[model samples]
Target: MGASIDERKPMVSGFGYASHSSSGIGSAHFRGRGRSHAPFKTWIWRHWPLLMVGSFGAFYLIHRLSHMGSSTSAPKATSQSAQQLRSDSSRVQNGKVRLSDLIGASIHLSEVAAHEITDVKFGGKEATEVKGKTDEGVDEPVTLADARSNSVFVNGLRELFPGISILSEETDPDLEEVGISAINGVELTHDPWLDLNDILITVDPLDATKEFTENLLHFVTTMVCVVHKGKPIAGIINEPFVKDEAAVWGVALDKATEGADLRVSHGLQPSTEDTVAGADKVVISRSHTGSGADVVSEYLPGKQPVFAGGSGYKALRVLEGDANAYVHVTKIKSWDVCAADAVVHAAGGEFTNLKGERLVYEKDDPMISGGIIAAADSKMHAWYVEKLAPLQSSHGDKHRI
Candidate 1:
């Protein structure tokens, strides 16, 4: 189950101080030492005001010394350490590495994996052997590509931000062992605002695995999303099969505006249009199309349904204005949609559940119940939600609008 909007609130920022204890001589030690205290009392009576001033001056000096030590030592620390100890604490509390840098790494690694997968000769032995089934019972083609890509991303992220937990779809035995080793090598910095355990990174190294196997390269993508306490804060989607090798990323902390124009680095401008006409196109999953097709057809009437593979690719179609909306009425994993969700939201679109609630990532169970909807604009999203209410209410009676 996904977290509610109230449960997805931003975490509070603060550092916790560890407590320590020390043993000391009790008051009984002074009880027998009264003869020595008499001389000290006589001396204090003779110069009480001087002793008082000296005590106050010493206290002030110690206080100043403590502050000076902190100021002087802070700058001398390494950049990573300084960032970890920032006063605001919340800025980089999740990790010292920048989100943009992480996204860049994800794109590069995904592209490398894509090249390996697509370069194989078509209709060859290697191409036929790529198909495999995952524990989830989904036909996961491109096992080699998925393993290599998972290794690259998992190792790269572990090296970049050690101690951050990663929840990835590719859990092959070899990859899991390598990832565990990589995680063990990380030396994490303490953060008060963020629990490293609570910061999860979800990855779909090769989305649209079946499409990639079928040589429908354009529909495949590599996705990475950063979830902080169940909420997605940053993400990257890399379309490695595209001619230009396009990659786009977005940060939720940037305060993305609804229906705002987004100009990405790949020359893709996501539409900000708030209305969809009857002729507009709707993208639906090619592999899991059934009721989703019916709903799209019923809602938009004459709008054509564009069959596409990969949740990321479908969401990208909506973001790129190739499709006015994308709808799915099946259970999808967090990694399958989180990265695309971030990109769509940043691109002035809304990606939410059929109940009109935002999706939450990094839960113990990565499965997202209910269905999902992605629209080019908020108004269209609301319209889809209104239309889907009846289906949602009848679908297992599990979803609430």
Candidate 2:
């Protein structure tokens, strides 16, 4: 059982003393023990520790109550900071909803673009024009399908997110002007977070034009990537000719902090395993394997390298575990790799240049000059980086645009 109050020493409580002796007040009880009742000031000085503690608690309570009753007296900066915090939180929540909607729209646009590609590919004979020569000096071709698919994405996205900038491989200045003029009178939807000036939408309406022209449909893809403040945060890739499944994949990241929904659609989602184990095979570009042979032979010694068309297809090969890594030894255009890079990294993989640096999607530069090396995970990426460090500097002007 607990001891009785009289059996214990006196305790200092609040502004008063707690004692078992009811016959005295203040220090009177101590007088019997040779200590006379001290004056009020002396008593307060002797119990200064307790008084200070009590005063601080009361002050805190009053301060809290003042804040609860009327926050107008608080520092102006503090009130503004609290308001800004709430505003940021609201923006993030709205951003998640808008990003989710954007992902859905991207999937639908990809499917629509796929149909456009299919119609053009099988449409008797596709009239082609030599748009220009690639960085590798090969004649780059464009067909009617390219314009149609580009329109589907550019027109759709501009209508949906009118404030965001778009950079497409097949962006026609005249077409853009027409699209802008068309949407000028239309009341477009607005998303506070996505409507910011820093957002960029990049599109590769038809990733493998050469393969598509040659009826090599398996390598064809429709791709799009979303870059905010120079960072690729979302992506979509659609395999138009793959017969297996839905073939459309997408992912949006930064959900917890920036209000993005970390959700991925279909094939772009991360697998159940904590990490993927691989290194036996490497997927290289079929058309632009500039110095891939020597680099792979020297660094990835025993591994087998398979050459394939389309940057998106090569990236998917690594993501689906058909290959451990995807290595490109020549310069690549930004639009060709941005969506693939985003999709690969979003699924717990790594995508970077030969120097082990991430590719930046700046508005002025549309080229990834250092080539690329994408691996399944960090450990595999580090292994590749260590092995391929030598060739990082060898691609001199060949990689430059």
Candidate 3:
């Protein structure tokens, strides 16, 4: 559900005024007031124009003087604000905090949802169940954690960015209360600077639910991606199981002009060094490796593929250069990969489908039928796509739905 341009008038404050029609405040209004002083009233009536002009002149002069004072002091204030911003930006190790200030509430919302998934304990069989199969024919499960976290994400995003469109995986109205109550006690920051026109916000309140149910907490994540005109511009991935400040966020700060580059930063950790040695490594899905092994064998040759769960995690493996590339030749969803795609691209990495085409995040359909291939750099990505495209087209044709 994407918003149209006409419905996206930002709710920020600006200069405005209320006008009153003179007919509503005419002589009839003055007559109701005590007017016993006839001599004064007569004199005032005759001299009213002169008195009004003098009063206007005096007020105008005072207004100009006040404005002059403000003009004189404005630069210093502006300079101080600019200096403070720079000082704040300098402390960031990975992500551009300044550019992401507009989406602070979303980042916080993802973290809140993540923490709820890990920190809260569920009761009985109510905690988990096999929900249904995904478009890719994988058995997807829905957990109390998933529902509650999704509720928080959906409700919180709606509250913070009412004008922006939202798409969440779990939209059952009955389950909303599980997470909506949590938001009442939370206080999140808001920034009114980002343009909301034609923006679509997608959320994966809980990813790797099967891993979570199995107590494999490391792979579980809460994700949010901001898509503008079919491109992901900002993304946040929160690992609730990670110790402290377990979030990694990225913003395509220059997306309007150059959407390819992104500024990525860890929540509080330093940027990890490229530990990848001469022998290349590839990462693929642990649970659903459909055609991934064949892809690595046919395209990567000598490289051994490492298995992992969660698209966000696999993308990070490539982002950290622990793996040279990540390839998947099965169906996937926009919410599962959009945040990771933004982060990898922001850091100057490359992400595209097996056909060597950039994935479009149109809100009308969340399914990305072509699958994905992400790499730490452009050359490595090209290397994989050149070898794998034909094989992918031949075997994974159903994925092209």
For residues 1-401, what per-residue lDDT tens digits would candidate 2 score against the true structure? 75655565555654455665444453312224454556645867777888688768767877887779565522322221212212111222323325544555666677778888888777765788889997668888898888888878876664455444678899542223112212221112322245446667789999989888888888889898877777777788888888754644545356543554453435744332324443577888767665566567777877877878898888887877777889887777889999888888778778898778888898778877777889867888888888877665664453341
Superposed model 3: Cα runs more than 4 Å off:
1-102, 121-126, 135-137, 172-192, 254-264, 267-279, 398-401
Whichever of 2 and 3 has more TM-score, that candidate is: 2
Candidate 1 deviant stretches above 4 angstroms: 1-97, 120-138, 172-195, 254-267, 274-279, 396-401
What's the CA error at residue 388 for candidate 2, in Å?
A: 0.9
lDDT score of model 1? Answer: 0.63
Say which candidate scores most in TM-score.
2
* lDDT tens per residue, model 3, 1-401: 75543233222111111123333321111223475778547846776666576567667877887888454411211221212212211212232222354356667687778767865543343377788986557788888888778877765654334335677777633312222222222122221144555577888888888788878878888888877678877778888887775577776545354333345555422222435552377788876665566667766678887888888878877776567788887778888999888777767777898777888898789888677888877777788788776766566664332
Q: What is the lDDT for 380 in model 3?
A: 78
The parts of candidate 2 lying over 4 Å away from their true place are 1-97, 173-192, 255-265, 268-278, 394-401
Per-candidate clash tally: 0, 1, 4
Full-model lDDT for every candidate: 0.63, 0.69, 0.65
Q: Which candidate achieves the best lDDT against the true structure?
A: 2
lDDT for 28 (candidate 2): 17
Q: State every prediction's TM-score relative to the real structure.
A: 0.64, 0.67, 0.66
